[model samples]
Target: MPKQIEDQKKILLRVRKISGQVQAIERALIEQKNCDAILQQICAARGAMNGLMHELLEVHLKDTLVVNQSSEQERSEELQNISKILKSYLK
Candidate 1:
């Protein structure tokens, strides 16, 4: 398969896994599970979300900075956009 398609599939799989984790959290809440267990699940889900974000950011950086042959101005714009996204993400 093409690299892009493969990457997309991997991303989708990660999304599904994260969804499952979220559902598990919901189920735990509904079942009135222990607070510690629920907190652990929330932490797990958060970690998974962070992993997904990191993967997506890496792909975006590679596409914008390394893979594409953009002009200097375009590159500068892309960097600004990435900076804006990172600022928002960190908050």
Candidate 2:
């Protein structure tokens, strides 16, 4: 609970920003914005989403594994699992 509360504000802010970006894309589509500009906006939105993902991963890693680490073996296993998750997520 403490771990979650730490980043809740920042995380919610990011979600709101992502929502705005999505809406902007919708508006651009309706206005028939230039092809290149629309593509750039889409790319920007993708970047924002990726940033949100990174923030989420950082929070999870710190709150779940780093904070609760009990032993070297557990730490190693959790790190491996997190690494695999990141690889799959990026893919």
Candidate 3:
């Protein structure tokens, strides 16, 4: 597990890079670049965004909803629910 501040910094950096990739994609389209190349760029951007979303959700689960369960039973249940959500998202 990462420290909260470090995780935030990583997320922010990814978001910034994604923004740049989006701008590149826009320029590629406006310039009428090759369709396959443009599609590849778009796919890269989409994957980056997906990764960021996954990281953010994981951090949110760790920091918020699953933070205060002191009992083993409660923690186990929370983890199960979290796993289900993650599976759905990844799928």
Candidate 4:
């Protein structure tokens, strides 16, 4: 399989695991589990999400800015797009 497809599969797996962690949090709340356990799960899910975002951003930067063969204008446009995304992401 292509490297991109493999990377997408890995990302999807991470998403699924994060989803499960979120569901567990919901279930814990419904079942009146301890606050510490619920908070720990939330922390884990948040860390996983951050890790996924970092991976995607790195891949996007490399694909758009480093390995791309576009014109200067196109590269500038891509950089502007990335900047916009980062602004919203940071907010």
Q: For this target, which candidate reaches the highest TM-score against the unseen true structure? A: 1
Root-mean-square deviation (CA) per prediction: 2.3, 2.3, 3.8, 2.5
lDDT of 2 by residue, 1-91 (tens): 2277759888888889989988988999999999898898889889988998889888877887778856888888878998998899879
Which regions of candidate 4 deviate over 4 angstroms? 1-3
Q: What tens digits encode model 1's per-residue C-alpha lDDT throughout 41-91?
A: 999999999999988888777777888889999999989998998999999
Return the TM-score for each candidate structure. 0.92, 0.79, 0.69, 0.84
Model 1 ranges with Cα > 4 A deviation: 1-3
The runs of at least 3 residues in candidate 2 whose Cα sits more than 4 Å from the true structure, single-residue gaps closed, are 69-77
Cα lDDT of model 4 by residue, 1-91, tens digit: 1137766787788889999999999999999999999999999999999998887777777767787788899989988998998899889
The alpha-carbon deviation from the true structure for residue 43 of candidate 2, after best TM-score superposition, in angstroms, is 1.6
The reply for model 3, stretches above 4 Å from the true place, is 1-3, 68-91
lDDT of 3 by residue, 58-91 (tens): 7867765566546787767777977897798779
Alpha-carbon shift of residue 75 in model 2 (angstroms): 4.0
Supply the global lDDT for candidate 1: 0.88
- Backbone clash total for model 4 is 0
Q: How high is the CA lDDT of each candidate model?
A: 0.88, 0.84, 0.84, 0.85
lDDT winner, 1 or 2 = 1
